[model samples]
Every structure is written in structure tokens, then in C-alpha cells.
Target chain A: MSLSDAPGPRWRPAPLLPRDEEREVSLHFVVAVLCFLACLMAVGGVSADRAARGWARDLRGEATIQVRPRLGETGDEAAARAAEAVAGVRGVTEAAALEKQKAEALLEPWLGKAVLQDLPIPHLVTVRLDRAHPATATDLKKALDRAGVDADVDDHARWLKDVERSAGVVRWAVAILFSLTAAAAAAVIAFATRAGMAARRDVVEVLHLTGAKDAFIANLFQLRFARLAAVSGVFGAGAAAAVTALIELVGGGQGFTPALPLTWMDLLTVSPCPLVAATVAALSARLTTLRLLRGTL
Target chain B: MSRQPTPRAAAAYGAEEAFDPTTGPVVRFQNVGMRYGRAPEVLKDVGFTLPVGSFHFLTGPSGAGKSSLLKLIYLANRASRGTVQLFGHDVERVARADLPYLRRRIGVVFQEYRLLDHLPAFDNVALPLRIAGRKPQTYRDDIAELLTWVGLGHKMQAMPATLSGGEKQRLAIARAVVTQPELLLADEPTGNIDPEMSLKILRLFVELNRMGTTVLIATHDQDLVGRAGMPVLHLNEGRLSRKATRRAPEPAAPDYGPELGPEYEPEPDEPELGYDLGDEEGEA
Candidate 1:
């Protein structure tokens, strides 16, 4: 009789592997953690590199002159003289004297605002060296001495080197963190896939005897893991993003923002984290299952 | 390429006709040997041929490799030595992609029933059809009727754990035959059922054999083998011996005791018992 003639209950076979609710939830948690760590590392690395470059660009080919108030000269008068002397130098491009208020503000972080007004703060002059005829700190100091200005020349080379080195170390640390997180994630998935295969060995044998192709059986696992990774990766990335946004929000009020501001592009770079995670999970599952099936079945 | 036999072709080729080996045996093995990893060979120098549309019983002791021999026949295990062939194709030479199709033509009823516990009886029996990519709407009625014929009509929605041993065996048998495979292999199919149910299950195999499907049953049940009166392939300590054919007795009417209720019918139509070959041809 034709099937249409019999109105029976319609049914579909349960998948060879059940949803594995507990295992999957645990896997999601792991993948999410890995994704969060990887994304945070990536953001941290990019921000550090940008900050280093900004600091270098700001300090490169520049020198600062500090003129103390003489016995009878006011601080402003000495700063004016130092600025004029530095600007007159052959290799100097421009020189600007810091006002009393600006100088006080620079010291505000170390000393209280009102108290800094009573102290004898050195008047500061910033000198930009000409690119075509760069001047050394020694040459600038000698030129200032010859101009009868009592000032000290600082090239900021030591500070710039330290900043760049620290930034490099931070970048490397971030990269190492990323690598470790990825490795840990892969290891976790591989272990879980192996456990899953062991748990479902009987099912695998039955499917094999019943004519299921290796690819079909592998896909059943690969697809599930890929989906899990993708979903968890998103959750982890989202959590990381929220945490970063909070840092930015909290740090903004205190005027302690990073040298290079975080941009939407930074977040966009981390957006593909989920896809990468899914790919890694799928490949790991596929390879593991195929190898196991070949050896055992 | 060899084409799968259509329903019309199957109808034309009666099961009672003797198989002509000259055309080639449906299954052939030469000096086949098998072992698990570094373990000793469980099956050694086993040679046999199962002709098209033939029925035979494999009899052996518990450790005599009956299941192992069946595994070799169904492509579940490869022989360490010698060659094996199924359906005119060298098993080793068959492309991996083509293995599934080859497997689709062979149905196996495992000893444990191996029903997915999460699925109901209806879904369990429909597994072969689903593996063959047949949609539910197309085979729903056929499956329901097959279950009903196996006396499992009322237990269609019951889980494997809920079904009795006889019911599970019946479900497994129904699953094996649902695809109407060209070859049906059963490993101790009647091991757990009562004598009456065993006879009934044997009749189902007989009906399937009449429809041009080769049947091989691996079991140690001598009474069942003797009652069926088919040729027997005996295995002892990895060695095989063939028993000469015996004249088959006429099938007696099954006595459905009062407990069986009206569910036990006298007989089902032969055409209904046979799979609609149209589905096979459609697959082509």
C-alpha cells in the first residue's frame, strides 16, 4: 500500500550523538574564556604599539631647555631669553617658552595645584631641531651658553628609549598571551573531541556497519563543535569589548587615557575572532574523528 | 556499471530457482584470515560463496567466529589475508565514496538489536530508509505497515527500554528488512525470542527470501535451523564445514494462542510483504 494511505505518527530518528547538553555547555564556557583572552591581548598589543609610535613621533628630533630664575631675573624673563637664544641657533627650527600657568599645570600631577604657585618652578622652553640640519643636545647647550642664557638642554633620548623598550616588551607579552590562549583552546577542544568520540564509540560502530560514510559521521561532530566555538567566541568577545569600554569610560574622567586612543577599527579587527575560533574547532574535530575512525573502525 | 535490480526484475527472478555460480557468486571469499590488531587470528582460511537469492544458516559455538565471519561478509572487518568480493565488485577496489551505496544494498540485524534508545520503535525501523535518504512522507505508511505486520503496531511510539525482548527483536527485524536490501544478514536474530515468535520471525525471513533477497542467519540455535531445513555453514575453531542441503518442510500454520488476540493475522499479501521495488528504481 502507498504510504499516503496510512496516516501514522511521523517521526525522525534522533541524531547518533545526542545534543550532549552538559558537555556542550562546558565547552561553550571554555571557548568563551579563550576568546575573551585572545581578544584582550590583541587589543592590548595594538594599543601599546600605537602609543609607542606616538611617543616616538612626539619626541623625535626635539630638545627641551630649562632656564632657572637668576638672582635678579624673574622666571618669565629668563625663559624669554632662553627661547630667543634657542631660536637663534643655526639648527633650531622653532622654540616656545612655557607660560607660568602651563608650567604649573605640568607639575599639578606631582604637586598640588595651589601649592605649585608659591614654589620657584623652572621656566621651560621646547626646541624643535631642523630636519635638514639636526643639532645635538651638546651643540644646543653650547649655543645657549654662548648666547649668555643659563639653561640646561635635555634631548629626552633616555626617556624615549625606555618608553619604546617598555612598549615592545608589552607588545611581546600580549603576543605570547594570545599564543598561549589559542594553544590552550585547541588543547581543550582536542581533549573534549576525543572524550566525545570515546563516549560515542558504540554509536560510531553502528553507523559504520549501517553504511554511514566517514565524512557523514565526522561532519556530525565537526559541525556541532564549529557552532559551539562560534557562539562562545562571540560571547567571550562581547564580554571583552564591554570590559574595554568600561576601562575607556572610567579612564576618560581621570585624564589618564592611553597615548593612542582606542578606535572602532580596533574592535573591528577582533570581530573575526569567532570565525577563527570556529575554523580551528571544526578542523580539530574533523581531523581527530577521521583519524580515530580509521584506526578503530 | 552494474545496475541494482528493479522491483520488476526481482519479481521476474523467483527465489526457488537455483543460483548459477557461472554468472558469479553474490559474495565470494578465498583463504580469508582475520585478527584484531596483534591478537591471534579469530577467523582463518575461511572460504565460502553465497549465491544470489540463496538462504543459509551459519552454525558455530560461542567463540567459533560466527559473528566475525558475518562481519567480513558485511564489510565491517577486513581480512588480513586473501581477497573478498561482494556484488561483483572487489571490496578492496571499491572507492570509499561508493562503500555507502554498496552498504545500502545490504541490511544487517545485530544481536543486541542496537536500537537508538532515544528514538521510538517507528524511528528505529525507519533507520535504513533514512540512511538511504528516503523522506518520511514517502515511506511512513510502508514503515507503519511493516511494524504492524511484525505485531508492533501498538508499540510504534514506545521506547526501546519500554519494549519487551520479543518486541525489540521484532523491531530490529523490521528495521533490517525495511530497506528491502538485496542481501539480508542476521547475527543471532532469534536468540532472545520465544519459540513461537522465533517461528514467526523465521517466516518473515522466508517471505523476504521468496522476494529474491539472499538471507544469511548466524546462530547456534539447532532447532530453528533444523525446522527451517535450509543448508547450514558450520564453523569450528575458525574452520568452516558445509552441511549438505536437506529437503525443506512445508511451513505450518502459526498457532496464535488466545493471548495473541486478533493482532495475529493468518498471512499478509506477498506483494505487501515484498518491498516496493519502485523505491529502489527511484533511487537510481
Candidate 2:
């Protein structure tokens, strides 16, 4: 609490303590670390989801054409026929098909040890569109079905939907992390304010006997804690920025380069986390101090 | 303005203005009653008013409501069924914001000294000024001189727990008078001190009164009161009475001067101690 009575001339006011109180510092450090980790996870998940959504947007309304396993016993002629069949199909302007080996490699990332490589993975053809050839995905699928080859058309929309839903979970986790940081700040502020109140019990009584109103007394503590929280918050935010920078710098050259670095704008958005934490601390301290002072002194 | 103090008028209009603006009593009480919660009353029909700038002794047995009455005057407790005006404003009607100013004008010496045990005597004395927002640097010299006057100059840096009872009482008095408040209330201020110290304290009150501060001392020590030749308000079983004022007899001077010692011998003019309430009639 500010000692408002002290004349300004001779009084050298002490700044209220920052979060550097050993316990407070440690607590902030923990919250900072948690926030940092959460930010990284959130940023990473967001990047992956963005990339997936981009792929989905590009693939929507398109069908892939694959031609292989013709009834006749030659693969090359079947591939040649597959190209012609797709070009002639309504709604298909062009076709660039996947080589069999390439499809096996795509499956290799998840399926493992494919003995079927020699047996021929299917020849997958992706059909491109000419803007005015008005044929729906259903019409294309029916055309591929009539072809002698075991051909299939994939719209890719359902796959995108699944990826989008999974990304939603990551976003939810980020939201929860934000809430947890706030709750932690409030808890720490309450604990610290209570300790301060206990230590200053006699001082409080003297103030009361001197006819100080409860609001005046409560304001002193509230303002003190506000200063403490603000200072801590500024430092915490600075530290978070520094750590996030280091993370981006170090995580940059690694194999797991964050799918994409958080843009300057995104980083700027996160910059206020420390301020929010501090505000939570200040408000919690004020509320706790007022509540306990009301009940006791 | 020249009217003699009426206990009722004094209570209705506080003691601060009861005296002639030039020469009236400083405090007056009339039918002042106090109770705690739903329990029975602690003080009943208390009535008296001290003359302007006069020193008086309040004597009653333990539990006789002496402290409660002092509390009412000091604005610590309110009267349950009567008015207690201070400086001419009814205390009950006084704004909360203004209470501090009123309290600031009245000095109180508690029996316990109520020293902020953590602070040294110098700081303790400076508390009033500090709370009032006076800079420590500004009042530091004034406090030092007062502490020295009370013979506590050497112990200025000492804590309350370390000081002897006499030293503590002196410190309490120094704190009470530092502001030169209009009224001073002492509740057995000398209870823990030696007779020599008691007389020294009594002399301090007399000196303060001479300087025009109104003082009311509550103590059961009749010998102390009689020797001082001050009027006494004796309280018994929730009732109050005023004993006649008598002048000291042709006297031998009691040496109450500053010699640090244990016993205080009475002057020949001093009346015999006669305020034993234990032998009084049954309580009402």
C-alpha cells in the first residue's frame, strides 16, 4: 500500500516488489514455460491445419484417374488407353497420372515394407478440369466405372473434412491453454495477497484505529499488488518473446521446421499474453485482499 | 457562555466547547450509557463535565466502566442511549471521513501503551504525524526533542518489549502529546510504574493542564489524586459522584523531581488515600 501520508520531498518511495519474490518468480517461470510450450504446439498445429486446408481447397471438385490392370496382359497399352479414356470423358480436360512406384512410396510412409512393389501398385491418374466442361463428380465416377480398367475417382472432400475436424481439436487445446494461464495467475495473486495481509495485520489495525475507511485500506493493497503484477507481467512477456524467438530461430533449420514460421502478425498477437497474465494477477489480488479484509480486519 | 457546566449539556454538546470559549470545561458527560451486543449495559447514566483546562481524576473499582467511559470520549466506542459530542458536533452524526480529524485532536494514553512493538520509541511517537502524512524528515527533530524531554533520549532506538514500564509510560505520553491535542485521556497510565514514576507522570499531566490542555485521568489511586489536590469523579456500580475539592495542607514538598528511583514519599499537604470501592454498598 502506498504510504500516501509521506510528503513527496523527503520520501523516496519504494517500488512495489515485482514477481521477483522467489516464490512468485518461480511460479511465473512455470507459467511462462507452460505458455511457451502451448504457443509452440498451437502454432505448429495451426500450420499443419493450414497446409491441409490448402491441399483440400486445391483438390475439391476434382477427381483423380488411375488406369492399370487391363483385361489384356500388357500394362503399357492399358496406360495409353487410360490416358485416352480420361481425355475423351466429359468434364476431364486433361490427365496426368501417378506412376505405380510413386503411389507405393506415398503408402510407404504409413504402410511399411511393401512386398507388393514388384506386384505393381495401381497407376493413379489425376484428372484436371477445363472450366466450361460441366460434368459433376458423380458423372466422372460413372464414366470411370464403365471403363474396362479397375478405375476409381476420388473427390477428396471427405478426406479434407476429417483433417479439418482434427485441426479443430488442436485449436481447442490452444484455447484451453490460454484459460489455464489466467487461472494460474489468479491463484498465485490470491495466495500472495493473503500472505501480505497476514504480515501487515498490526499495520492494518493501526490504520483502522486512525479512522481509515475500509476502501482506503483495500486500495492500498490493491494498488501495491497491481504494481507487482504489472512489473512481473512485462518481464514475463518480454521473456516469452525472447524464448519464442529462440524457438523460431533454432527450430528453423531442423528437419521439423515448423510447417511454417508464425508470421510477424501472429507473433504480435501473442505478445499480449504477458499483459493479460499481469491483469489477472492484479485483479485477483484486489479481490482477495478486499474479501479477506472484509471478513477479518 | 459563563454558565457553569451541566453534565447533560456537556454530553449533548461535547466537552471541547463546554468551557467558556475563553474559560469553560473541555469535556462533559450526561446520562451516557454503553452496552455491548445484547448483553447488559457496561456504563449507566454516567454524568460529569471537566472544567475548562482543569485536571481531574476518575476513580472506580475494576470493572466499574472507567475504560468504557474513556473509550466513549476517545471515540473508540459509542454510547448506547446518550449523546457524546466532541468539539461541539454530535459524535454519532460525525461523518466517517471526519472521524480521523476528530481523533487526531484528542490524545489517548492506553494502559497497555499500545506501542507498535516493532517500531522503536521514536517511530512510535511519530506515528500520529506519519498517519497524518507529515514527512518523517520534517518531524524527526521534533520527535527527538520530545523523546529526550520524557527522559527517553537514550532509549529512543529501543523497542517497547525492551523498555521498563516507566519508560513505556513516558513514551506513550510523549506520543499522546506530540500533536498537542485539545483533550488528553489516560487510563491508568501509571498502573505499571513505581510510585516515584507515578508522581512524575501526575506532574506531567499537571504541567500539560497548565499549558491549557484538558486532561482526565482514570485511576483507582486516591493517594495520587489527593496529593495532587484535583477533583475526583468516583464511579461505583454504574453510578458516578463528585467528591469535594480540597486544597493541599500546609506542605512539605515531595521530591518528585527526576531522580530515577522506586518509592515516592507523600508531602505533608497530601490527603490520606480514601477511595476504596471494595467496601462500598452492594451493586444495584
Candidate 3:
């Protein structure tokens, strides 16, 4: 009879770590919470970035002309002349004089509607520039001066710069948050591995005495943690996605449109969070097991 | 069989003369001393040579460092102070990667019977072969045959916790000898078994020794030692001494009697028989 025809022994090494149901549940909960927070931070950072870009794009070629009432000229007349002057500029596409009430309404939120009418608000002339042929703020101001209108030209560049700076800070914060979460998860897995090794010291010693290699023992732990991390990551990602969808729905119900609308693709970005968590867990477990084995044996 | 030159014999000829490897001992310890970290030495100035294919019993009371000596021979414990040579190569000089290869040639039945409680009797016996990277199918029949010879065939599927103390001891012996190691170091092989089972286990070791595997069994059972009629290496308070020999007439055959049955024949092609086993005149 050949060796292949003989019956084989049916025995496998029991898992080095006993399955602690409570501990497993707690770990999953912790990992899921971290993952959710990370996903939310990612989404918030990306949305802020898109909003800042949109604001920059819309304000790029636009300027406003504010006219003051001269001694003999009415505010309306000055604004009309300024608008006409802006229209004749090289790259100005359309210029219109703002109505007195509409101009006062712009300040209504800060100054109160009752106080706005009595104040001598500047007559505002809004100008839209042809994006293909942009006009400089200096040229527009020079044109307004020649038209006998005393007006100040504002290009909204300072506001856009502030927005971009805020967006950059948010992005950095989000990245830091993601890194801290990953590190925390890895720490948890490493601690768990150490405890498992201590608990299974007898089994490990026997295996070692029996000539089992360090790599063989480490692989068992690494694979277990990786699987647990993956499952927890998925649950965490799902919860975060649900929370984001709820926020979008509520915001939409309040007649608010997001700066950039949420799409299926935006939600799909959270899918990789679990994979990242799993990698961290596996690496942590492997390193911890090897280090412990080296020290003990 | 030829014997290796002992340290005393070598010293008489002066240290300058080198020993030949072809006829050297299977294990040699020269002034070996061992201690745990920061602890007093457990074994001191231990020096001996187990010539190739010899059988000896290590006898001492509890805490006499019999186990520690076995550890030294099996490469589990490195001597704190002296040189240990196994298979004619210095253990201290052997690389860490090569230690496992050296350990494979030595089989040890631990005093505690260290069987995996989770594994069945058959798998426990098959452990050494498995560790040696033999496919299970390749060693299945051999494991079954060995387990049966140890009288554990009925308990082949039994877990260690379910087995009796005697069965556990037998299983451990089975595991140790499964790979047919060149040197077998059994720490108290018959300590927990009945006299009948003890004799059977000793016979198994005797049969293994006859097949050219060197055997060293450490036990405090002086009766068992006396019955075996082999050379005794006595350890007292961490000191070792070789007791005088008592030779008996060689038996024509090892008549284990009708109790063992005809199936218990030692393989005829075994290279050498270490000793002849004869029935005691008044035993039956």
C-alpha cells in the first residue's frame, strides 16, 4: 500500500487565544466608533474643500462698485453713472445699479431693518466681468473715477483667501484625526495580542519545545486580529455612512442645498476605511507576537 | 560495540590527541555545569560519554537534577560552564538555526507527559513525525502500530484528559519514539504506571535500544532499574557517579511470556541488541 492510501491524523492546533465574546464585542464597538469618526472627518474635509473652491470660482471675475452721494448728486444718479462706466470697461459683461431698498436689505441682518432705511447706505453697482477677458480692479476703479463717480471697487479676493485658509486647516485636522484613530486601533490590537500570548503561554511553550518556528506562531495571531478588524471596520463604515445620509436628508428638508451635493461616489469613499483598519491590526499583532516570542524563548 | 574514550581515558593519553568521529560517542559532556539565571548550579561538573548505541538508566531521588541532565543532553539547557558535544559537534558552537536539527535526533519523554489535552491519542503519538514535516498519510500506519504496541490501541481516539495516568505515560513514550530518534531521553518513563505496564514500557525501550537507538531513562524506581540489569548512572545532590556493573547470562530470547502474545516480536532486522533479557529464576 502507498503512503497516500493511508488514513491521515485529524488534529489541528486549537486557537491560541480563547474566544472572549464580551471582549470581542467591545473591540468591535471600539473599532467601529473610530472608523465612523474617521469617515465623518474625511467627508467633512472633502466637502469643505469643494465649497471653498466653488466660492473662489464664483468670485474670481466679479467686482462691486459702491458709490457715495456727492454734494449735488443723488445716490441713485451716482450709482447709475458708475454702472454705465463699468459697462463700458474692456472686460465688463454686465453692470446694473442696485435699488436703494435692495442695497439697504443687504445690511438689514446686521443693522436691523428699522435702522437701515434711515442710514445713508452707499449706492451699490454690481458688475459681472467676462471670464474669458478678465478686467483688473485697478482699471475698473480708474474708469469709475473718469465717469465723475466716487466709488470703491472690491473684488472679494480677501474673503476667498480666508475661506481657503479655513478649508486648509480643516483638511489638516481631518488627516490628523484619521491618523490618531488608526494608531489607537493598532494599540488596542497589540495589547490584545500580548494578553493572548500570556494566556496561552503553556501552549506556546509546548509548541516552541516541539520546534515550531516563531513565524508559525505569529501568523496565527496576526490572521485572527486581521479578520476581527475587517469585520469591525465594515460595521463602523456602515454606521458613518448612515449618519451622513441622514444629515443630507435633514439639510435638504430645511431647503438647504449643500455646496457640493452628496453622490453615491462620495459615500463609496468610506469603503476603504475597513481595509485600512485591518492592515493596521494585522501589522500590530504580528509585531507584538514576534517581539513577545523573542523575549520569552 | 566499540566505546568512545572517556574524559579519564583521554586525559591519560593527554589532551593533544584528537578523538576520531567515526567511533566517537553519541553524546559527550566534559565538566558541564548548569544553573538558572542568578540561581545556584543544579548540575555541577557533570562529565560522561554515552558511547554509540548504548543503554543506561539515570537514577536519583527527587531534585537530584536528573531532569536537568537530560535537558543538557537534549540541547534544551545550555551548560553554564563547560563544553557539551552531541554527535561529535560542540553544542555551544552550533548556530541557533541548527539547534532544531540537533533536537530532532533526540527524543524526550517529559516527566509531566506534556500531551496536548486537545489532541487525541493518535495525533499525540504522531506529533514528532508531524513536526518533522512528514505528511500524516505517510506516518499513519506507523503511529497506529506504535500506539498499539504501547497497549493504547483501544484509547487511540481518547483525549489526554480522558486517559488514565498509565495511558498518558504510554502515549508520551509513543510520541517520543515515533520518529525513531538516534537518542531517546525519557525522564521517569515508568513513574506513574503499574509494574506490569512499567515492564512493558521498559521492554519497548529495550526493543528500541536493540534497534541501535541509544536510550537513557531517568527514574527513581530502583526495583525497575535492578530488574533491567543495565549500567546505572547515579546522581546524588547534583553529583554523578557510575555504579559498578552486575552482568547476567544472555537469554536466548526475550520471553515476555504468553501475556504479550506472539505479535510482540522485536523486528528481526534490528541492527544490534544492546542486552539480552532473561527471565528471573523466581519471578514466574
The candidate scoring highest on DockQ is 1
In candidate 2, which residue ranges exceed 4 Å CA deviation? Answer: A1-100, A109-200, A213-216, A219-297, B1-30, B49-54, B95-97, B194-200, B210-212, B243-284
Greater-DockQ candidate between 1 and 2:
1
Deviation in Å, model 2, residue B122 alpha carbon: 1.7
Q: Which number leads on lDDT?
A: 1
Candidate 3 Cα misplacement greater than 4 A, ranges:
A1-26, A47-63, A67-97, A125-150, A253-263, B1-26, B94-98, B122-145, B210-212, B243-284
- Of the two candidates 1 and 3, the one with more favorable TM-score, higher being better, is 3
Candidate scoring better on DockQ of 1 and 3 = 1
- Give the least accurate 10-residue stretch of model 1 chain A, judged by summed lDDT: A1-10
Q: What's model 2's TM-score?
A: 0.64
TM-score of chain B of each: 0.80, 0.80, 0.80
Q: Give the TM-score of chain A, superposed on the true chain A, for all candidates in the order listed.
A: 0.73, 0.69, 0.83
lDDT of 3: 0.75
Flag regions of model 1 displaced more than 4 Å. A1-13, A60-94, A98-124, A128-165, A253-273, B1-22, B37-40, B93-98, B134-137, B248-284
Candidates arranged by TM-score, highest first: 3, 1, 2
Tens digit of lDDT per residue, candidate 2, span B1-284?
11232454344444344334434334556677889888788888776666556666778899888888888888777789876656555677655545666677678998877777767777788877766666667777777777877778878778788999889999998888887767789999888788877877777777776666778889877667656666676776666754545334335546555321123333343333333222233221
lDDT, residue A6, model 3: 23
Interface RMSD per candidate: 4.2, 9.3, 5.6
